[model samples]
Target: MDIRQLARGTVEWDRLERVFRTLAERYDRTVVRVEFLEADNWLSTPCVVDDEWFVKIVTRQNALVHALLTTGRNVGAITSGTGGFFDRFETPLGMVEHEYEATKRMREIGLNAPRPIEAFEVNGLGVLVLEYLPEFETLEELPDEVVRELAPELFEMLATLHEHGLAHGDLRAENILRCRGELYFIDATRVLEDRVAETTAYDLASAMAVLEPRIGARETVDAAAEYYGSSDLLSAREFLEFVRFRPDHEFDTTKLRSEIEKVADLDRG
Candidate 1:
């Protein structure tokens, strides 16, 4: 068994059926077909219902994992010379509710996101429903040329989020979806509103980490330069080592630092 599967535990078949049945009753449908996604996700069991709604079934185990991840992320923030900024949830409903609100806020800010339908608890599971996108690809699955083309747009979106005092506490290739030539963000985690600078820098570092390997450090920094000032890039540089500690992020950190310093120097000159 995969370690993550073991860690995530399994939702009993009867419980899952109860969830589906509840969904059907809530949506006024006589029946619904569910297609489970084998996603590399630690927090939820994802599925598509009747090809119309994307759903996440969050269990007690998922909430435990989320708490653990939040602790680890907060520790990483401390190592990067900032206080703990990540928020933790005590229940599956809290996790789903936070994500639902975050997605709604993204769309409200003119950013692309799946439209949130509802979040509710059924049979001890947190169920979140959203509009399903039939066609899409993750940033990691896109071609290098496409990623290069989208890099600046990615920063533009991030900048807009930062400008509005919001941060995507989780910014990775998989969390970014390219659907029909537009980018859609998902799975934004909660962060402290009072620690805006620290969260902003961390988000920028995560974004560059996502792009650096595919687009090269120079181009990644170049893309960031368009939307962020040299100081913001420098702030992000502080968290590169911290971001690298995560298993999902792997990039040439040395090269990235050099590129950022070069850009900073040019701005200074």
Candidate 2:
């Protein structure tokens, strides 16, 4: 709808509530019963309904722009703010469709991600309902010892997602969870469709974005490599590069290609 207005600032709380109400009515769910998952937060807020489903509204413009910009460059289209940028994500509804499809695709390949429940669009916001998998704790919530033991397992989860031809675009530690004994990846919002080496590489590099701080970079990489097995491994130097130039909502990867050069260097040695 209003591209200029939306891009100008963050979505206001009152406005988001209003938008949520309008969309919730279409689902025949009462707004009063829903408790906002987190308040005083900046990004999308997911609400748990009867502890069975997690629902949220998202436009994911930044993520969509990254995809468009990446694909555009390959075809040599205008990078950002050009006709292509706005044209691609003109409908937040479409973005939701991508996320829904991504979620379903993950389940199709036997990956442990929340299953999509229902989806709809009202005005410009897209509404999504996902099956709730309760009793999960984020990677940040674990003790150092647990993180050390789970790092390899965490890496394998990502590896499995990749091996099945899917890339969890948002692999931040918070998006990763430990429930029971398994690692369940949340926020498959920015999954990759290209399914190429670069897409998978960018996904792993994004993994480094958070893993480095909590459990140390090289340690995590080595552990992940042990389980990842066939997929490429990141060295200390490559990891350093990932931190600097990892993918973002901005859709720039000039640094990612440069980092790919040193993957063969084996910085560990």
lDDT of 2 by residue, 1-269 (tens): 35433432254577577766764576677763555664222234457765667777665654355455445433321221112211234455765676678788877877677888877775566777888778888877888788888777777777777787777655666777787777777766543355345556656666655565566655655665575432364332233343344233221234433433334345443
| Structural RMSD, model 2 | 6.8
| Residue pairs that clash (backbone atoms under 3 angstroms), model 2 | none
> How high is the lDDT of residue 88 in model 2?
34
For each candidate in turn, the TM-score is 0.99, 0.67
Least accurate stretch of 10 residues (summed lDDT) in model 1?
1-10
Instruction: Please give, for residues 1-269, the per-residue lDDT of candidate 1 as tens digits.
Output: 88788878889999999999999899899989999999898989999999999999999999999899999999999999888999998999999999999999999999999999999999889999999988999999999999999999999999999999999999999999999889999999999999999999999999999999998999999999999999999999999999999999999999999999999999999
Q: What's model 1's TM-score?
A: 0.99
Q: Report, for all candidates in order, the number of backbone clashes.
A: 0, 0
State each model's CA lDDT, in order.
0.95, 0.58
Q: What residue runs in model 2 are displaced by over 4 Å at the alpha carbon? A: 1-32, 39-43, 59-88, 229-231, 234-242, 245-269
